[model samples]
Target: MTTSAILMYVDVWIVLCFYGYLLKIKKRIGFQLGMNISIVMGGMAALLSGVLLITQFPFHFTVITMISTVAGLTVGAVFGLLFDYQTFVTGLTNGIIIGLMSPMIGTVIERPTMFIIFLHGFFIFSLLTIFHSIKRS
Candidate 1:
């Protein structure tokens, strides 16, 4: 598969993971953390958008990637603030991290890089979440 295709899949999975993690820990975090998440997401989204524009990648690729990152971050943040500020921020933060990191990692692997990233992230964050919970308790 092409790099763009792999990146697209990576993006989708990243969003999924972002939501998954948020659902797991939203109630445990606070407003400050949520605000921080929003700021990080916005910054990452702007950076990614700038890179996309400067690099002049294919039109669809740029549009899809940017939209996914920006829209997901914005909507997630809004939803989090509306329903649960913590959840929104957590989701947006994770989404930004995944969105930004996936493309770079995808470029390194020849094939099946998306799967590797997904598994790697799942395991790492799963452990982190568990650790955070344990620490809190």
Candidate 2:
């Protein structure tokens, strides 16, 4: 398939898998860790979605921003729900702030393909770190 389609699929797949994995370990984590996880997941997912969507639909800036923001907030809220109310709110707030800004970044960046590559690496790195922390505790 095309690059945008591949990136979109990768985004959806990673988030879904991550959500499933979180469900398995929710009982073991505390608010602190939960908040961090939500923050990282929501922010990265929003950013990536915004970039991917913008690259695919260059003319629809506002619509893409809204879509990405909702995606981030939903992902964050779900992740945070596994822990506590406080965690949920924390995640929701972070997701909103980052979501609002993510589209702007997507619009300005000159080299999206390279940026997407680096972002996926960073996102995976963060997820691995969270997984390691969970394993330790």
Candidates in order have lDDT scores of: 0.50, 0.85
Evaluate candidate 2 by giving its C-alpha RMSD to the native, one decimal: 1.0
Measure candidate 1: CA RMSD.
7.1
Clash number for each model: 1, 0
TM-score of 2: 0.95
Worst 10 residues of 2 by lDDT: 90-99
Per-residue lDDT tens digits for candidate 2, residues 5-48, read 79789788988998898898788887898899988887887888
lDDT of 1 by residue, 3-92 (tens): 435544554465456556655766765655555444444433433332333233433444545554665467446535633656666757
Q: Provide the RMSD of all predictions against the true structure, rounded to 1 decimal.
A: 7.1, 1.0
Q: Model 2 clash pairs?
A: none
